[model samples]
Target: MGRLPLGVTTLALFFGTQATTGSLETASTVSAAAMIGMAAGAPLQGQLLDRFAKPVVIVCFTVLQVATFVALAVAVNGGSATWTLAVLALCQGMTIPSLPSCTRLVLKRAVSAGEVDAAFALDTTLMEVIYVSGPAIAAGVTATWGPQGLFLGCAVLVAAGTIFFVRVTGARWLGPDPGQAERAPDKEDLRPRPHDSRHWLPAGGFVLAMALLAAPFGLIECALTQFGTEQGTGLSLTGLILSVTGLGSIAGGLAYGTVRWRTGPARRFVVLVLGQGAAITVVAVLPSLGVVWTGLTLAALCTVPLASICFHMLDLLSPPGIWMRMQSWGAVANTGGHAAGVTLGGYIATAYGSGATFALVGLCAFLAIMAAMPALLNPSVRRPEPAKVGAHAE
Candidate 1:
């Protein structure tokens, strides 16, 4: 909830703040810093949660997150050193709550096993809807108020959500499931048993796949803003384009959940990813924003469903106690991919243009899909359809 909106808000902040700052490059650097922090931050939080009280860990990080946002906003607005701005963003990233993973973890306590899939479907769908609305909300907030006000609003939202999530429910929300007595809180238990070294291949494969999928999205975010700017439509409208993509994804995710694939999750993964790559490439070739929007909508349709499949596969593959670790690593992979895309795309769009940058992202995604083919074929990675997927899921 808080995390999705914050991410899109920061994108608006970065794209919008370039006017006050000397160069778009500096703002991109600042956004990249946050991206790097997020790439590493969630996993760090997961590690801490393993040893400490959940509420304590979340509270401390939430405070740090707020302070970092304030510091970041000040630096960006005051025309402070770019390095300083980037550093604060990095600090802020460390505290960005891994809300999606948290929601999935807590759902069992909130609902029955049979209904968990429905809950996750609803959760993932709703999250996409938030992301769909995030840019629009950020644009509106910035227009009505300002980028600084937007940043303040983000900080307040994050702080409030973190407190509510951690305090309102108490220990049971964070406690271990009572029925799973065999699932001890041991580091070793997180790994796929009897195959400490072997699990790495599947894990690595998943990480890479997720990263590849995410890179295009990060690049697209930056590219869309630049494209909108170049067309004289303004960055705010570009944000609206993203909302359209989100709408497409909502439809796709819902459709994906209804259709039970005849093949395993891996097979489905290959198809969806390749489809996204093709669509992204189309986005690069097209000249008009309307055409790009069509391509973006097509790409968005595959995005969530594929990610859902990946997470579902990983959950099946993960050992009992290490669910947090596994999910954290996946988040790292996704964020890392996004960071690379954003950083690189920002640089390319600054140096060349959005068209060239779009091409580059499309090519990279295509290459990644080709690279992932071998990895997806791994025997250990095979799994039935995701629980939250269609009713026919095995």
Candidate 2:
């Protein structure tokens, strides 16, 4: 609920603004501002998790999100100026805290070491479901009920998600309380301790792997839209393509959950990367809408499995105290990769064309496979204990 409603509203606001103002450039600027705001606040939000109880932080951010949505609803209704739009976008961005942080906090406590992989796979699958459902709902609601309805619905959804999460997780008290296991040593702590530097190498590797895997996806959205347009459909059909890809992502995530692979996670990551690179390369050769659609679907399928591997690795490798922050950092890597990919993709698409852009993304995916090879060879990847010989070598 924390994600779905906000996701719906963000789409509604974005496309709704496009519908209202008929300015794609302006809408893109607005969305970029919001995303930049979200990215900038990510680390600081993680720092808050480092200091506060997970529940308190989640609740506080939810309230702020709702208030901002309410204000956004009013402003959009009143036909606010561009400055108003930019400010509200920034507000929305800052209030969108790191979701993986909260999820990591709960999972770190709930699951045993043996079950961590399954738990994180479940989490990744659920997020895939959300990605599929959110935008579809956004398209439906914005077309029918308008942006005002979208905002009101989002406000309610966020409120309920926060309440439900707190109840289920038994996080009633704020901050560190008695008997909580969160007092374990974190990566940021000054005091020297055993677990302090233990998981650094695996965690760093996990972050890098995620960043590499995310590169193509950032560019794919734009290229896919162009593909749709080239097939004689207008830009509006891009939503349908994205929705279809989301379904494939859902299937891939579920498949990852069910498969009981014997290979270690690092090796599994390499396999997933190979599949992703191959699928993305197919996108470059699609000659018709049907073929492009199939290619996009397969590529999305590749994405979810890679995401599951990365999150599961982080969960296994992170210390209990800094699990939330480690997850946040992973998210930061994904965000940074997306940003860089989008910038590069835009330049390539403009200068050469979407076909060239698709080829470049495929090349990036192939490069990701090579980038992860070293980690796959390391026996200590996702090891629970620090290597005595490489204690200082992250």
Residue-level lDDT for 111 in candidate 1: 66
Most accurate candidate by TM-score? 2
Please report the TM-score between candidate 1 and the true structure. Answer: 0.77
Q: lDDT of all the models against the reference?
A: 0.70, 0.68
Q: Write the residue-wise lDDT of candidate 1 on 1-394 in tens digits.
A: 4565454655755754664575888877777777778777888887776556667777788888788778766766687777787788788777877667766677745764344434555667777777677766877877776666777778888888887787766687776422243355555333355246666666666678778777877788788878987899988777688777788889888877655455666777778777887777777888587778788888888877877776755654565456666778888877788778877888888888888878877787666666565456665344443344344443
Worst 10 residues of 2 by lDDT: 385-394
lDDT of residue 385 for candidate 2: 28
Q: What lDDT does model 1 reach?
A: 0.70
lDDT of prediction 2: 0.68
TM-scores, each model vs. reference = 0.77, 0.83
Strongest candidate by lDDT: 1
